[model samples]
Target: MAPAPSADTLGTSAARARSAVLEEQIREDPGRFRMLTGDRPTGRLHLGHYFGTLHNRVRLQDLGVETYVIIADYQVLTDRDVADTLTEHVEELVLDYLAIGVDPERSTIFTHSAIPALNQLMLPFLSLVSVAELSRNPTVKDEIAHSRQSAVSGLMFTYPVHQAADILFCKGNLVPVGQDQLPHLEITRTIARRFNDRYGNGGTVFPEPDALLSRAPLLLGTDGTKMSKSRRNAVALAADADETARLLKAAKTDSERHITYDPAGRPEVSSLLLLAALCQNRTPEEVADDIGSAGAAALKKTVTEAVNEYLAPLRARRAEYAQDRAYLHRTLREGNERARAVAETTLAQVRTAMKNHY
Candidate 1:
């Protein structure tokens, strides 16, 4: 007899299946879907974020999906010691969202700190999940390892539960995620399932959200490793044209005179090719073919030009938005009010379902 498929394999298979159906449904009637996705306000937004998820958020919103973006300011405390600059980071995030075509009129953008009822749901969600299960979450483990801290905080351990609340508080039924993040969504789905099974009273209070996997390949940093702000390999979306060219000038690439698109064999060269391809909406191979025998200098120049041109309009918009801090604040204020109202409704339903509506 054949051995059973592993749990990870089963999960991946199930996610792909659900995603196919979700895509078809979205095509037919996008307004029927509500998407929940966001970022931690730890640092400035970068190219990795733009291509990976930000662009997708804009596309979905344009397609008529109900979009909600949370700044996740509270999540930064999981590993960091202070939030003194938290306010600045939140405003910068809002600017980045608006500059990238995330219209406030269409998509709701709010911060975790602004939604009390949303955080309140965490208490009950915590009860539905176990300590062992939380500890077993791979994404949580990866975060803890990368944190390089000697001791882990209880809040850090319960990070996934909070994420579940972030999604379920607004009754979100669709979440855009990468493959690595599926574990976090799985726990969220589990919480939704257990909560409904225990307190649903034969009627579901929360919908189990499915993962809308990102189609974009991971864009690495200039140093030929993962694109990260701390690593200083990432290109910030707010970087000026001169700074962008200067950074690309020093990018890592092999000494081969001829360029080729072999990510596994020539990651450094291939990474630059991928960047140009993404900017031009062409394939990496096509970019590589165009730069044949031009060597690393020409490749770097091509990438810099592509990146600077692509980001010019976004950076222009960001600069304009930055000049008006009052508008940014007002946007947040309005988003928070809208999010709170939604959370209040969801919490009220939870109270009714659990027979605690007194």
Candidate 2:
């Protein structure tokens, strides 16, 4: 007989089952769901962001899910200082979203700073969770280690709670996240449940959001590490064909002459293969098979061509959007107003539930 599954395995299986159910429900009645997902205006979005989350966002939007994208500008202060370039990064992110088919008309896109009521939820949310729970959060620990700061900020410590506010503010029921992000979403679920239990008085306030696990695999950097703009190993979606080629040229690959996709034994080669496969809508193994015996040079060339070709239309659209700064700002303004209105309504409900609306 097979051995019993471990707790971790059971948890993963449960998440998968829940994700499948959510997907089916989304297909049947997308209007019944509200999705909240976004990025920090830290830097220009790269291929990782494009293939990982942006594509999925567009898919959900097209499926008619009411989407709320928060720019999380405040979150950036948790790790690094990007005050000087914050506005620039925000505008560029807007361009990427538009180019990638996230229609402002269909999906609301707003920044954290613009929604006061959203941030106000943080106070009550902070009271629900203990310091020990916050300290035990794996995501926060991982981020702190990655940031390598000598001293962590209070904001950074309570980052998960801030994320909770982001979700519950607009009553987001479906959050698109990768496996690694489950812990953060778990905290959000906990807060929602605790809030309702403590103050609901037979009325539930925030929906206990379920994770919509991302299907995309983690895309590594050209240097065979995590893809990040700070590392100078990422290929931004706004990069031109020449820039894309230049970046791909420096991608790490083994000395193996023959091309193959082996993520464990040959991560670098397989990463490039995966990049090309994602762009071409094919499997990495199929791509490696096509390039067998062609060598690393051939692999790099294929990846460069595939990435450039795939991003060509998006880059073109981004270029056009960048030309009209006024329109871009206007889009943000409208989204902020919409998000603020939603947040205000949710805040009112919270206050009434807690008898603090006096």
Candidate 3:
């Protein structure tokens, strides 16, 4: 497999895109606010979700931004060998989100399959987007190649367009994303620009959303690969203490018998240190320094203890919420309603501008 691109390259591209967005934002509105970010409901969110994306969303909610948590249920089929099990996966994801302090009242949590207006926006946006541009999107290409599917469905092919609908529906001006997802956000911005230029009643109908840069941690699995449910390399957020402990105990560490923070040569040790720091909001250097004179065994033990302790409260909250099916459904029901209210409004204006006249 080809090596992943270095952060230096990704950083340069991100800076350029962010500068362009910021220039437009200042000219548009100084205090403009609205955020859109979503997760693919392909499986239950793991520690990667918490350390990577969820925590940022929680912070955005606290900052008084209108946060929309979209479970891209429709995106699941884009790369599934068996798509029938998604219902349970989506439920577990919702429960996990709630357990992590994603308040539905402040954050609109809705599934992609339930939002009709957003899907409708996909139709016209699709018309405006070209096959070449979609094919050029790094994420769609990477996903298609990764899925190894013999024949990709049209829905899978146009997942980015659907994402544009997610942002445009809410007129979302900010998108919280990591480096890997910048390409997808770029596609969304391009679509927004194309639509506005073509049919944006006089002034641009859609404000191009900028990537809300997140200081996301690089999460790894037990095998030192990227954390993924399919690889069984992930520790689920809803996992009990015993489960988390077992996963951590089995986490891939080196035979050096000593811990070090050198990721260049000691990836496994670095991974464990990264995980511990993420769990406790400390720097890996800080954690390593605090583990002075404590060898590898002691370092791993301390990290494991810290992670398990941190997640204990989250697990309790998850258990309580998971038991109430009615509450889950009701929360989602209301969330979908709120999401649709905003989505339908933008979609209606889009229709009028495009002469769809629905």
Residue 106 C-alpha lDDT in model 1: 88
lDDT of 3: 0.82
TM-score of 1: 0.96
For model 3, the superposed segments whose C-alpha errors exceed 4 Å read 1-31, 292-295, 356-358
TM per candidate: 0.96, 0.97, 0.90
**lDDT of each candidate versus the true structure:** 0.92, 0.92, 0.82
lDDT of 3 by residue, 1-358 (tens): 9999887587657666775675466446534678888788777788888888888778767767778888888877777767788889878888988998899888899988788888888888888878999988888887787775788878778988888888889999888777777878878889899888888756888999888666677878989898987788998887777787788888887777656688889887888898888778888878878776676777768778888888999889999998999999888999999998988888888878888423
Candidate 2 Cα outliers beyond 4 Å, as residue runs: 1-6, 356-358
Candidate 1, residue 59: Cα displacement in angstroms equals 0.5
Using lDDT as the measure, name the better of candidate 2 and candidate 3.
2
lDDT of 1 by residue, 301-354 (tens): 999999999999999999999999999999999999999999999988888887
lDDT of 2 by residue, 310-356 (tens): 98888888899889988999999999999999999999988888894
Tell me which residue pairs clash in candidate 1: none
